[model samples]
Target: MIVGIDLGTTNSAIGIWRDGTAQLVPNALGDLLTPSAVAIDDGGAVIVGMTARERQSTHPTSTVTAFKRWMGTRQTVTLAGKTFTAEDLSAIVLSSLKADAEAFLGEPVTSAVITVPAYFNDRQRKATRRAGELAGLTVERLINEPTAAALAYGIQDRSEKEPFLVFDLGGGTFDVSIVEIFDGVIEVRASAGDNRLGGEDFNDTIIEVARPRIDPEGRLAEVDPLVLHELLRAAAERCRRTLSEQEEASFTITSGDRQFATTVTAGEFEAQAAPLLAKLRDPVLRSLRDSDIRVETLSEVILVGGATRMPIVRKTITRMFGRFPNAAVHPDHAVALGAAVQGGLKSRDADLEEIRLTDVCPFTLGVDNSAPDGRGGFRHGLFSPIIERNTPIPASRVSYYSTLSDNQRNVEFGIYQGEAREVQGNVKLGSIKVPVPPAPAGHVHVECRFSYDTSGLLEVDISVPASGLVRNLVLMDDDEAPNAKEVEARRKVLAALKRHPREDSHNMAVLARAARCYESFIGERRDMVGKWTAQFEAALDGQDPRVIDSARAQFEDALNQLEGDRYL
Candidate 1:
């Protein structure tokens, strides 16, 4: 079965087409949501989902969370003495979700439709596809997250001629999209977002206020920074969640033998998160401006993502659109359901035969040119737009330019993305060098065509009309990463990873958690967990499934008797 996955920054979910509708596939925990976390225990067993998330507070040094923020970057996290890239952690999460889907469907899942932020740049989109490959999934498409939300909603609430505004604020990113659903087509007119802004930032706002009160002497700073930040982040996340309902939430700060109790009000949270909330306006306005959809004309304002449950977020969105946001679909499950719908469409399900989905480029794409400034001198390094922002894709646009110098044998065209007037201000995506016969400046004009496909990958073809010579290049910009080669190697590693005995996953997870519990506690508790951890490891190594299962059952009873579910 080809499934649809919402590989979110906070919690991931998967779905499949079942009985002419989308069905959410539950994880091993028998829940539709799985925490996006990865932790490796001292015993070398890898744990993902809820187990890994719980391990983060205890074994902060060996756990990774929110790695999606570094997907296209060169940053690496040191976990359990091994260095892992963001894609590596994402691959682990995707693999776990894949297993959950396979177990639920009772079949092999070889392909998937993954969703991404509409404003994700070329590198980020490439990184996402590579991550899916590393999870042994043939990624058929990368649907934009907001567009996916709309698709999920549109399937249920069929609007023939209304414009919909989608406000998506997830754990690590925010996206606003203006869509018009009409004539059997779902078209995204414009999309905008702050890639660095999201629920995590709001949590950090609480961290900024609570940290000093929690540890007034900065005593936690001298011991371990990772642990300190992890603790603070955990506390802030709880506080952020609590404020979503009640007017005030009680918080207790802990540092060694020091403790303090404080109450954080919703008003206080709104004050601290004001800047981030303010940032929510620009993208909405820009998207509406680009779509030419006035606020008065919007038929519905859709709110999405786990972060959108916060009162301030909803208030900000309502303030932007002058209407209460629609809560038709469950925020956390909508993207996955929409992705499942896309998967159904890909499989050509009879129910969705007339449904067509289209997306738009979120940013303007162009080549750098040093043309006449309209004064006496030339305006060097100016951005010349070939494909304007909000244009529908898969799209193709060509821009022609001539050589600058006398007898110039080659022309270097720098591809950039942004709405800036100058090349330096815009993001330089890649460059293409086209060779030409010796000619004077402006003599040999060449045609450079940019083709952006549905997956948001950009392909540039530079051709000289006279000689008809053409050169092509794929964007591989991460120098510190092997990029293409590393992805292939990791894909093979994922194949091996997926081959683990599925029946023993529970036992292995418990052993990994026991190791984590032992790592976190002290005195008698630590020794007890350490002993149970050893027993479980030995039982697993004995290679008999029933014996291992029996040992796990006994050890889990002992664990519950001692520490309850605190370490589970």
Candidate 2:
């Protein structure tokens, strides 16, 4: 069966179309949530999910998280005698989720609808697709995360032609989209985001406050640096969660000989988080402006992503829109659920026959040209837009161009994407040299057309009517982005690797959790937790699943007692 996946930065989830509704698929541990982490233990085995995240605190150098932020870049995360890119790390997560789905469905699944941040450029989108390929799945479509969230909300409401704004803040990406439900169709009018911003930054604010108190001289690097960091992070996460429930919270970093405690009130946390809150508003305004959607005209304001659960983020959005966000669709599961619905739509599921979705290109796409400013002079590098931002797709727009000078034999088609009026401020999506018949200025006219498909990929066609010459090409600007051949080669290489033992994933997760719990304590209790954690690790190396399961349950109970209600 086809499914939908939200390959989130902090966590990943999978859903499938069942009957007339989307059903979430649990992992091997029968848990709905899985941490987006990958770790290689000393045994040289690759492990993913909760176990990997827990192990990260103890094995900081061997584990990697938040690699989704590095997509479309040349960044490499090195582990286990191998240097891997963002795609490789993400493939591990996606593959683990695929295994979860397969285990639940009792079938071999080969295709999926994956979600991406709405504002991702072509390169980032392609990287997500490549990661899916490496995981042995054909990514049929890439749905915008916010749009998918909106779809999840829309499916429940029977209203028609209602406009709403979706403000999505995930673990590592932010997206603000203005959308409208026309009859039964869902159309995204505009989208804006900072690909590098997300809810994780909010957690970082807490860490910044605690670090100075714990490491005044910053000499921890010379002595047990990883443990110190683990303690600090564990405290920060607990502190953040506490503030969510009450006005004040105390975070303690106690490990071995180091002990430090700090108390922060919600007001103090909000004060420190002000800068991030401000960063959240710019995209919301930009999205409304692009879509010409006034705040009052919005029938609803939808909040998506686990970050939106933060009081400060919700308050910031309310202050800007002058309305509270709709929490009908849960922030964490909405995108994945919508992706499943989209999967159903893609497969032409009978229940979704009446539902349709259309999304716009988030940015303005155009070519560089010298255009006259109403005055006599011309402005160079002027970005002439063919398909303006917020125009619903699959769309095609054509702009006419003339020869720059007499006997001009070539037309440089410098394609670009962005909202800036100056081409230098925008991203250039490669260019092409389309041959044109040499003629006097303005005599050799050429028509350039850009077509943005449903998947948001752009293809350009340049034609000279007089010479009967036509050329078309898909744009590629970054040299690092792999082509089809390179993707296939990488996929083959990735498929050859040994799959991680899935049945042991639960043990791994609890061990990581134990490590995290161990970071927050000291003395005899710490020793006991450490001993149990080690026992489970040793048990994992044994053959009997029952032995490992028994040890895992006992260790988890020990950790729970040590952790109590404060599960840092």
TM-score of each: 0.88, 0.93
Summarize candidate 2's per-residue lDDT along 1-568 as a digit string, tens digits.
6799999998889999889998789998777767788888887778888777777767878888889999888899778777889999999889888989988888998999999999887778888988998899999999999998988888877478568898899989999898888778898989999887886787789888766776687655665776566556657777887787888888787655666777888888899889998898889888988888788999988888888888888788888878887888888899999999999999999998989999988778899999776786677898899998878888999999998778988999788888888899987787878888878888988999999987767899999999999999875335567778887888787666665678766765776677666765778877897898779879878868899878877877777687654231
Please write out the lDDT profile of model 1 over residues 1-568, one tens digit for every residue. 5699999999899999888889899877567888898887777667788777867767888888999999888788987677788888898889989989989888989899999988887777778888888888999999999999999988985658588888899999999998888988998989999889988999899877776765677666675777777766766777788888789876654444344556788998899999999999899889988988788998888889999999999898877777888887899999999999999999999988989999998889999999776785677899999999999999999988888778888889888988889989987887888889888778999998888878777888889987889998665453344666767887776455423355555665576567555654566777888888888789878988789879988887887776445311
Model 1: worst 10 consecutive residues (lDDT sum): 494-503
Model 2 clash tally?
A: 3
Off by over 4 Å in 2: 221-231, 254-256, 372-379, 476-479, 534-551, 564-568
- Model 1, TM vs. native: 0.88
Task: Point to the candidate with the largest TM-score.
Answer: 2
User: RMSD in Å for candidate 1, one decimal?
Assistant: 4.3
